[model samples]
Target: MSTIDPTGVTLVIGATGTTGSRTVAQLTAAGRPVRAASRRAGPLPGAEPVRFDWYDPAGFDAAVTGADRVYLVPPVGDPDPAAVMLPFLDRARAAGVRRAVLLSSSAIAEGGPAVGRVHRALPGLFDEWAVLRPSWFMQNFTGTHAHADSIRADGAVLTAAGAGRVGFVDADDIAAVAVRALTDDRAPNADLVLTGPQALSHDDIAAILTDVTGRPVVHHHLTYEAQRDRLAAVIPPEFAAMLAGMDRDIAGGSEDRTTDTVRRLTGRPPHGFRAVAERELGAPAASAAAVHPESPTGAGSGGRLR
Candidate 1:
């Protein structure tokens, strides 16, 4: 395999997902060539959407073909992601993809428990790589989740994080920083911890939502056990346990700190939770009321480290 040119095509692994989609949009808007890799190869304006799946190793080469750089996001629900990601990174390197930007979680830094292993192993696999360790996504309250729907209905949020503050980030900002890393030679072989400008507790986030939507939104805290029970009813027990464990970590003051990585990389301070709330919750009853017709309960919101 020949060394990939820096100006060659950039492939986004999870093009349909929140961050990936925004990355695609930003890259395309900037007139950079992009190949969007997902399960489906559909018509995405200004991009060549291709089919790729992490579970199917046969499809990996096709996805990485002729790409210079790749944005790698592990598939959700994989208990051991490094087992899949490490080998895939090897293949991409072998296929001449020189630079890679990996979207890792802030909770899984070098010393952290589960996801740290991947964080530690990534830089060794490629000549140039960047690990994006971002905090909770602001999309949890706007996207397809019980929280978003509940917020639309009852104007309330629920979480197990009693008063633990989180530096929630906009997925768009994460994507923007990702595009810069993938395209610019300045970002290389670094681990960036990106966060919002300020740390805000769930209660603070609720207040912001109320102010943005002109509705009575409140934060309802629950015990870890109660949160686990609520999540287990919808997702698998193991996944629920993983989520509950994260919350336990948060409650223990694991993710309450703030960082300046976003400003360092993007030349702008990270957006605050109130700003995100305004954009997502500004429309008031029109968007929120369309969420659920059957359920009368308000939406639930909380910080989940992504």
Candidate 2:
């Protein structure tokens, strides 16, 4: 791990998402100079917010101007982001950015699957680079999945992974580690697989919710085909297929391990699922449960390559 000077500005791409927003907040709170890049231009507290779009390569150079480090996150819908990201990394390198920290997934390692192709190609693009391989996020329970609605209405959670467990990490933990990689010189160059301290299946999560909220919550296990059919009614066919494929992987025991990388990088154990649910959901869990009906449940597992 090369220790580049940490004084120069760090640019944050995808500065509005769950992890990106938190990264920006943490970096700025630590008194580090930061430049937040997004498609929209606005004033972000404690950082310089600029207009940038991954679809428009013309905006790339300007976004990284005067920055020493960059946090690279790909756009959400690009089936193959490496094609778009490689050229941008080339630009950042030419523009004199010293280090880059990529937000990657545990599912897609250096040639594992769809997004893995991009992961495989990342190391060769920068002198100092670190890939964050994190498992499913704990946010889906309270933020953006149908599970949130299920928790709100029927007091249940749903998944296709019958007994598969996941070491679901908090997005905040991922962001904290990203901030360290962006600013500190001690982070490793190789892929970092981060996970929560413990692995919990959907049933375990449902039990936690039941305990914390004082409501009867249950985990509804569905077949991959059934889950796919349920999601197909609301999402695009391709996206639904991708989701179903992940469920298949989980059911097959692909994501049933834990890692200490979170603690190694950030000097703290990754937050537990219940802690995250409570922090994000808050007391009077009923009021929190009432907020979102369709909260996502199985994020943190990045989408698979088709």
Candidate 3:
């Protein structure tokens, strides 16, 4: 629970989205006022729904007005989001919004690329701020992601990351941390890397899924170009290339570590892949059997982690 008393509503962009929805739920459950912003402005039980489009600046004022804080989820599929986001943020700053929490990716660093530009500019835009650079979401395997699709259809996890490990964190944990960042007496004022309790390779993930679901599952490795081409069929070519590049980087051991950020901020350990799998996958009689720990290791429908 936040010790700080929230005076104004927290504007939650992408309210119907993965982390956005969870963040809104957590906030409302904590008795905090929230304004849920999405393109459709879909209604949530305890939130004020407002229409907010990244390209539509006309609605920006309505969303920012009367809100002291903002949770930013960058526009999906935009090659350069800072171009759209920075302007709205400037408007938000002028509107008296004091705190901002941004959802970014561990793959990208401040001032590095893509949302990194927004990550770099967040501090200058708000007095209190936090940039969450989380690892790959565990929901990718259980949600409406490509990985899940492959799992359901072909009983396999496709990836270019051969033996590379990733500290896949849960979206629920990410939202919990975001809620704290928004409601805490003082902002972290720094970028935090969030991850699960432990790192697991794709092979390990396959084993866990097989154990939980009582079905055989395998990790089908693909070449970088192959994965890029496969992803390009659905998303933009450049973005597909970028995602494939992240996988290649993962293969090179880029996302091979875990952090205590989630525990440090939320006062609880992050959820493991197996727990997420059982809860979200709805596998009957999901087992808690242990698997052999090995090495490391998607673009899914849940949108890029960034």
Pick out the ten consecutive residues of candidate 2 with the lowest summed lDDT: 297-306
Give the per-residue lDDT digits (tens) of candidate 3, residues 1-306.
232347679999999888999999999999999999999999998999999999999999999998999999999877689999999999999988889999999999999778999999998888799999999998777655557667766778889999999999999999999999999888898999999999899899899888787768899999999998988888888888888898898899999999999999999999999889888654442221212111011335423442
TM-score comparison, 1 vs 3, better candidate: 3
lDDT of 2 by residue, 1-306 (tens): 554666789999988777888899999999999899988956789999989998899899889889888988777645577778888888888888878888877766687654576677767777777888888777666664446655665787767888888888888998998998888866467788878889888889888877776667899898988878877776666666677777777878888999988888888888998888777665774445444434334332223211
**What range of 10 consecutive residues in model 3 has the weakest lDDT sum?**
288-297
Q: Identify the runs in model 1 with alpha carbons over 4 angstroms from their true place.
A: 1-4, 111-114, 284-306
Best by lDDT: 3
Report lDDT (CA) for all predictions. 0.76, 0.77, 0.85
lDDT tens per residue, model 1, 54-132: 8789988988989989998777655567777778888988888888888888877763444566778777777778889
After superposing candidate 2, which stretches have Cα over 4 Å from the reference? 1-3, 285-306
How big is the positional error of residue 44 in model 1, measured in Å on the Cα after superposition? 2.3
| Clashes per candidate (backbone, < 3 Å) | 4, 8, 5
After the best TM-score superposition of candidate 1, give how far the Cα of residue 266 lies from its true spot, in angstroms. 1.1
